[model samples]
Target: MIPTNRQITPETPLDSLTLDELDQLLSEKLVTLQVDLLKTYEQQLREHEETLDHLHRHRRAISLPPRPTIGQDDWHSYVYDTRPSREIASVTDLVTINFTNVHTVVDIFPVALDNIHAIYKLDSGNGYILQDDTMHLLTVRNQWTKSPTGCSCPGQASDTRCACCALGSVLCQVSASGVSNTCVEDSQINSHTCSSQSPRSLELDNAIAFEYHTYSEGVQQVVVIAKGENIHFYRLDKWGLQDFHSLKGHNTINLDSPVTHLGYGEMFVEQFGTVTRKRYLFTFGLDSSSKRYYEIVTNPQDFSIETGLSMMWDTTGTSMKVWQNGGRVIIGVQDGTNLNIHELTSDRWGRQQISLQQVLSLPAGVTSWRSYATGFENFLIATTLPLPALYLTVATIDRFLQTQRNIPRNKLQLVGVTAMFIASKYEEMYCPEIGDFAYITDKAYSKAEIRKMEVTMLNELGFNVSYPLPFHFLRRNSKAGSVDASQHTLAKYLMELCLPEYSMCHYKSSIIAASALCLSLKLLDGNNWSDTLTYYSRYTEEQLLPVMCKMASVVVKSSSAKQQAVRQKYKASKLMKISEIPQLKSKLINTLAEKSASYA
Candidate 1:
């Protein structure tokens, strides 16, 4: 069987071999190839069998309870409106009368006066009373009218036509002819609905501007009203308005400006070997061009305002929120077109000092106001929708990778999927089982592996998974702008496109929604941004242009082969086939590019 080849050495060429030797060499190579191919096939089959086994085990492990029906609990009752039957027309008519001529409601408060449940409606300059159960509007005195035509004095039969009249007044009658008492039933007032009922007006002596703040601890409720240079506090009981307290500003403290914002916070004090709850009030004032912050302790019998940190800051305070039970204060300040966060430390003493935490620059095409609102709106929506939860999960994973640069690229999808699992559990009523998630991935990961990865992700994220998504803001902004359904869907499509781009996280949810809405409107050739939209969205065309361009770029990119989830989702007929709108996509990209370059 061994060929000698005429005493051939190792230097003998294969081409110089005899015909029988060549046939033997080819046959041996063919046998080796067949063996290798069989082994590869066997390995792949084993892997497939393992995947199937894992899926079967996962299915066996999952056990979901039966879905509860409506009226099972408070949440179900709210969603299903499981209250006692009432006249729908009467309720609608009552609401119309109560809200008439009220340009903005601002705030509403409910209190039990004696045995009657009453609600207070605070309008810009006027106040109205409502019987909570019967939905009846109660009349009060000193109500003025400020119509677009002119202002009318009390008891005036004809239009006064005074330009200097105060804007605050009671809710106007629904009838356009004139003011009348027919809005409220005469019998209800004559019968004295409640024994302790009394007329209450929010008006303060010489008050040019006012704001309302409320806080509750256990059964005790307190309402604080800031008017001009004074802050008035009221304690409420089951019978309403128990005690009234006022804190007057002195020349030294100089609270001469209107109170722009009011907030209440609670802190835990650990001193003398015991922990106690301490409540505090935070007030922000704008004195002409200067902005000031005041902290006042509202506990310990003797209340005092801490003016140590009253010095003015250069930037104007646009919005402020207290989180972590008042331990952390997030202040949004305007620096040109950008909004920056000023985080302040808190202690038993008061607010220590302000430190600049983050500066959120208004990304080219959006205003600071809209951007700030978007972040909050996204948070609200994430609490309800699974899609938004998934978006947030993926975004968080991307954020972690940017910070931890050593993470392997292959594990990104695993981390993202685990995040989605966590978000779904936190946000959804019925979270998808682990087996279901595995199925979605075509069994790429087993249930056991995914469960392990969930623990890892939770640890990495510090168990914090709740965050806002752009969908919430888009829905809210679109509704407020009265945008059509088709246009709204298009805007949502645009927003989803931006979700995969990690860089888009720098912009706020409001800005993203506004930019998307603007682009959608342009593409649909619908009504342009109106004054109503501008007032509600707080964004101008100039501000949205840059953001729109960036969104357009994202849309174009999402249509490519690499990013297909969002594009495919929108390709369905139910979604209006937005992803397939080639003409609109092309137009948006080109227009945005030209506009963006011109602005630059």
Candidate 2:
């Protein structure tokens, strides 16, 4: 039932109702705020003679943007009334409805406010009133929008994301409506009885700062309440509040002093999706004498101090206000008058421990960089050897790279050069002199080092260099299918297309050859994966489809992909200029690629 003012009172048992019931009442019912909740604090302020002057000064500082219209509602009529900027603040994106009268609005939720002392603006469309004895939580109804503080770009196709998208800047416009989807709304409801707490401190006495941290282990949410020398953490579970203080550690984490301001972690990493994953807590400590900046680091399990310009260093800041992410801080001697307002800025975030992208970074590094080794190695080794020897060099270099560990980067060149020297001796009528391979890499290595690395590569690969090449399988499949000159070269080109890609490095020679033929046929608009071709390849149409799709996606991305060496190599006329084929970019090829891409 829709509740009326007569049905509920200041003494109503709101805690007894379920959260869904509270939502229905607040959203659909008429709300009467008859109690003079803010009267005690602001009753005499409006009568003060200087109030208008202060209001006008405040009005001049705010540069309001043009009104926003979302959904089908006529913004002026439904959300805003025609009023001068000074008389009515733009709060439709923040809180409130058109007031029926001075004392009543259409909707509001209640908290037991025994003696409301102050009301403060909470981030993300949430409201709370402060009282000396009891905390009042006002959950507003708001919708989370994916509608970005959006790109600062011209919104053109060719425009790169501006610095705000890559690295956030003060110039970034963070509307009260949203800040990178950090939850700000015109009206949002997000309170759950999901949090129940009994901390070392029974009440939030002398509480100063508050932050809601995003928790990832499910739909859980954690709220941190900062008090003198202590931080009380409250969290919500999927099942709602269940033993919020249930963790083994103490309910409140004690710190050295009262935290003036706290921020969620910010790592200025360039990689996408890694911005607060490191989760370093930034705490700003401001005093009249000396300013302090601390980063709560996990690796060292200790705090690091940062030095910055003095902030109100002579007179104690009555309160400190730090902006979102990182930037200048505003400190005032008194919270109200903005007295002795000074800006404190940190030139740099304090030193932080960077996590190794897991311990496998070195092995992954060796795999990616070894291609450079082969490029240099092949110039000397592949020059005089037969075409078969080129494949041998690639396969041996792949072997040395895949099995070996702890090889230095420059040393990898020695390994690659030596592998080619081996492939040359095995495939060529006479191997090139060991000294020739050494000279090709700008004489970076001596003939003696090449000899030594040759022995080591042989030993590490277990004296077994009998790896097959994709060309071997390609020749067999082409012979069976009677592929013509252009089709054969096109199939060869597709195999080479993936040569520089480490992501597909693990596919066997037979598999690579099969997928290449399949894609080449489709690109030429020919009958793909004929019976003879599939029998020779031992890979049916079904088996080769995933890999062919992968090849098509790679071709589509090659124009913009960071690794373009293979594409560039095949751009030559001798290689059929296959990478430059306009059909390689046809919509039909791309449509074929849009299927399930998670093929093993």
Residue lDDT tens for model 2, 41-155 = 2344334324544565697589876543321111111010111111222313644233221231111222112233233322222334434343344322111221223444444
lDDT for 125 in candidate 1 is 34
Task: Give candidate 1's error at residue 457 in angstroms.
Answer: 3.0
Per-candidate Cα RMSD to the true structure, in Å, reads 31.8, 29.8
User: Each candidate: what lDDT?
Assistant: 0.49, 0.46
Report the CA-based lDDT of candidate 1 relative to the real structure.
0.49
Clashes of each: 9, 10
The segments of candidate 1 whose C-alpha lies over 4 angstroms from its true place after superposition are 1-385, 557-559, 582-588, 594-600
**Candidate 2's TM-score:** 0.36
Against the true structure, candidate 1 reaches a TM-score of 0.35
